[model samples]
Target: MSNGQGMATEGEVQEGLTVEEIAFIHGHLHDNVGELILKAGKFKGLDVKKLAAQIQSRQKALKKLPEWSTNEKLIFPPALSVEQCSSEATAHYKASIVSGDRLIDITGGMGIDCYYMSRSFTDTHYFEQQPEVASTAAYNFTQLGATRIHVHAGESLHALHDGLNADWLYADPARRDANKEKVVRLADCTPDVAGNAALLLNAAPHILIKTSPLLDIDLASKELQKLKEVHVIGYEQECKELLFVLDREMPEQDFKIKVRMIDAAGQPIHELDFDREEERSAVVSYAKPLGYLYEPHAAVLKAGAFKTLCTRFNVQKLAMHSQLYTSEEYVNDFPGRSFRIVAVCKPDIREISQHIPGDKANITARNFPAKPEELRKKWKLKDGGDHYLFATTLADQSKVVIVCVKPI
Candidate 1:
């Protein structure tokens, strides 16, 4: 139905799931959806397709949103939303960073961030363009006893245009275009956060934007002149989200970049804060293969801390371009994977075999021409073993395979 503003709202979400449907969903929560669909005819008077979708979404949520997934009464949205929604680990991280009297999430897709963030604020407003999804989130919030969050079904920009203001403004713009293709640039995303930076700052002094990990932090900072902090967040060694915090009052020229690595339990593993000037001005020493090798975590690498690693960890860089680090004395507290060097030699298969003396070894290519698989095939090495081989270029611009083993 048309909302009379040239925008068509989807039909109101189902008032509620039927008792039988709920029962079916709970009973088959752990069942394989494909298998259940195969035997759909066995269940009478049940919407097998609908229940199957619910089960699928809930199954995904069990790991991503463990807190809410355990409550059988809470309904789930479509599989895409469940997959795209922020994991409990990241949501908790967002909530811990900012708090205020009033908070507004303009691009509230499934309300995962909004719900978690609401706990830190007195009042939270969630706006979503999709009517059905918004209503579903509202129902879920009620079921989860999140009374502090208020859901509004409409375009987020329209909500802001209508004089809605808050102490903190948050947005996780949709990365998909009208054709359902993924986009990386902030301007291409829905809500056009880059274009409306001024408007958003007018609505709220502070704004937090969650963007795709592929986005360049430097480019984004340049786009949003009021950028305050760039948080490069990693979950379980994978870069999950790039959060940019903007403040109207803070000067844009002196923004800081932070890299945080969190475990699956939403606990911090390692965190480092540095500025571009520090990274650029830091002195880094280069050395050949050393006793220990350290590889920075994904988040650290994504934040472009190539030379900063040396200054921060007191390690030597393998090469100017190679991200691998080395130290004569083992640095047990390194932020990324650590390895003890076993042997360093040419990338020749004969030399590798002489050093490894095994058929299988973990292969990693850093600043090397060949990929892991190509090198693996050429060197006749299998995928897994206690041995870890880093085929990288040394400081002298010579290719070498540095055989390493995990410290026991």
Candidate 2:
């Protein structure tokens, strides 16, 4: 809720408060958090300001991660700290990737990733620049009954200069600048994971770097060397994080990009991997909208998988650039939503009105001249119901509106 990094005095865990007092603070943090400082002036023996900060952090984290939110003993930093932490789902995905003897998190914020990542490894080192955050992480780890994580409060680079080696060295750089503005480029992120690639590679055989979901995958591969694989992770069909895993001994040319979706309807996981050459050389058929419409998952789209998607699904691309796909038969296991074509007509109100048989319909545009808002106004249609309209361009260079309906 609150954006500012409010009081972080929770770093002094159990120092001034007794067990009963800490228990009281945790009990009211759920509902009475806002009123505690206002009415009581002090929540038991805990600082009211600190209690408020913890409540705000916990409330925000609850939506993103219910596991951490329900933990009564978990110590959270200010709003900014919890805001930047990874969701439990994404962190669990990252932890599933590597399993070894040791792990070192170069940039630990709320330590959500490390908290899960440490489970796979026998030993883990969490390094954070902020003392309060680091102390909070240490306290939280203990509360979670962790026994292997070694919390280090300082710069991770300085700690790694001693030639420490591990199975994995991970870094999720701070994407914000001094002005609190977002830094889109990898080089701009604090700790400069791309700039100090050589040093990081030397610290571990495998290095995992998490970047913003908007980061260009191709550009990042060029910026960093010894690439092993790039993971595009999504949750509930929405792309969230871009993970790059670099192997010290691996060659750059022999790398693959794996696009993973956490939820694919009833299926638990959906994954597709392709190399640069394969994607470049892939030949996908193109055709007009025939029997059904297929849309790739969000993670697949983010992986620059326009061409390769059609090849994998054995479908035809609507156009060279347009990501819409079509096939003569139904694809039972298609990764995305499937819609059967009801009617394909030109962008004429007379034809659309006659066939609609409904008051409102959902609209989608692919490779069209006008945006959704402009087209909605021009089409004179309401926005609701199960009906769907697709305004797109065909391969023959014709702009048409295709009426698509969900399969019952």
Candidate 3:
């Protein structure tokens, strides 16, 4: 499998790290990179910089790509590649979406997604424009015993132009540009997925496009006329990826959105699925602070399921725009954090102290006039305690501080 560049391809590139380099990386895996750089001269004839980078990347992988991180035989890519690559959880989730005889990854950066997704297909084609990156990924696939993935070191569009077809096509376009500035628009991304939608649909029945979390799902869905589904994924309370699945035969304006939040241990804590029409037609009740307060996870919020959440969980919103929910009875299966309302008081320190005498609580401001930091200063409250103070507006348009405690 020559990469067709005349330069060294996967079959002919340097065969991963040298034994000495591997040993050095494994030995200093827990050491600080800066210290290792300072000791570079003492360790002669070693690519100290590269070794340090591998160590850092491995450290990060311990959490993001645990299975890969433990395999010493696999050569890690540069830090940026590791950072940009999808986590093991996300990659596996993607693999579960579609499966067939043939698959193609048009923007295979580190080949993480391709390697995992290839399990569901008989064969997978990985195309990367960067020769060196593609070569390293090819070597890694070999080390991981992924014999079904074929590496193509060139422009992805060129590969498609060459008449490569598949049952499924995948792409995670580079979100950052040549200048390293982050871009959120599909057109700004490398390979211009939006512009090449037709070519992709012609190449495969299904096309899965992964974009930055900052992407506007509704806008992107409208942009990609064949969009069939959108997935908003969150990890560690932060939105991470926006996945759009396109089908050649799918009808327009009929896409559904799936929002999921994964905890630190890579376990999904909450998941909600709804379409735009469902959201628009859903009705939610409103009320003052009740016995329990619920805050939906980042993914659900990003997916804009405010009304759906209310109807689904039988809860009431504090206000139309508050995005905070309340229920007289606790909903154990609610998708977000739950707290028992201790007291609802006026936004005065004296009234707040009457309930929260300790003056220590985790403060969150939702649809409030002041920021959390500013409120913290004005109320003379220390951060971090079992108590949580929510300063938000009620249905009657009155601001109040709701003190809450985690339900035992």
Candidate 4:
């Protein structure tokens, strides 16, 4: 199954490639190669090495598919364009459908957000600083079937200061400096959030700003007034991004925070909300630590609703130091999964070795002095297990041990 140039031809690639092979190619392909392969056909097996070899052989030819031509207007490769559009579109779609008319995208990166929102609104305005990015966006939008979008190729604040009116203002500032240093906070960007607030406030009745997940939520909430909702999106329990929605017309009520998890099927698996008062630790014991330990999601942690969660689950916090809660019988319908306590030992390696002499052990250290991986190495533990051991501090501020194993 090979093409004339030592690569697989369209027919051969489709016939020979596995799902995993296609995924690898999808991940590594350049815009041109990706466009060629996708148009050739979808691959459906697991021969990644063979697919890589094919791609390597055809690298030169693939480069000739089409450069990002502003005039010719070829199809934007799904690999390059779709990845960006998926994230951008999700944000734009969410904002557009949330009861709004006019939309102002302040930091229009590639214009994918603007492209999608254009369909849902009567007018859509996009602002971008880089000339190349702006041009690329213009071209990309045309390729994506968007013709009516207005691109403001300049500084976002400048465009905003020029008196743009919109029902919803969207901004995704450049979080990287010229030297490629990552900007972790609003203050680190070129036009800091504070500096651009006035312009944003005047531009629209509501503003939706996308910030790095690394930014401290507490600091961001405090700095951005009129912030009504904080959303943390996670995939398969791994946190991805944070969204802050600010509304100028509405007075500040109790802060509402939502944590959402989307599964591979594109369905929301979980959506939990916390009100202002629920974000506090409580003083009651819901239930005693049984055989399992459960750690809630990051949004739960951020909401600080340990008491509420404990009360709802009928569980008790393992200890003051441990953020995880424990219950005796298995709560099959728990929001977060549950794990059974398999083994428990002190932080001392000698003691740990005595309890579990195997070469592999799963180690988790929370509220303990040592890091998890470091302790794993110190105890000469390899990784393989349904077994989980936690080194933490008890409610009385005493060092304690926790061992977890899921019930069958």
Whole-model lDDT per candidate: 0.85, 0.79, 0.85, 0.61
Give the candidate order by descending TM-score. 3, 1, 2, 4
Residue 156 in candidate 3, Cα distance off native in Å = 2.0
Q: Scored by Cα lDDT, where does model 2 land?
A: 0.79
Per-candidate count of clashing residue pairs (backbone under 3 Å): 0, 0, 0, 12
Model 4: number of clashes? 12
What is residue 245's positional error in candidate 1, in angstroms? 0.4
The global Cα lDDT (0 to 1) of model 4 is 0.61
Encode model 3's per-residue lDDT on 312-356: one tens digit a residue: 999999999999999999899888789999999999989888777
The TM-score, computed over Cα atoms with residue i paired to residue i, of candidate 3 is: 0.92
Error of 1 at 262 (Å): 1.3
Clashing pairs in 1: none
What's the distance in Å from true for residue 320, model 1? 1.9
Q: Ten residues in a row with the worst lDDT in model 2?
A: 1-10
TM-scores across all candidates?
0.92, 0.86, 0.92, 0.70
On TM-score, who's better, 1 or 2? 1
Task: Give the C-alpha miss distance for residue 124 in model 2, angstroms.
Answer: 0.5
Residue-wise C-alpha lDDT for candidate 2, range 194-270, written one tens digit per residue: 88988898889999999888888887788888988999888885888889999988854477998888742212377
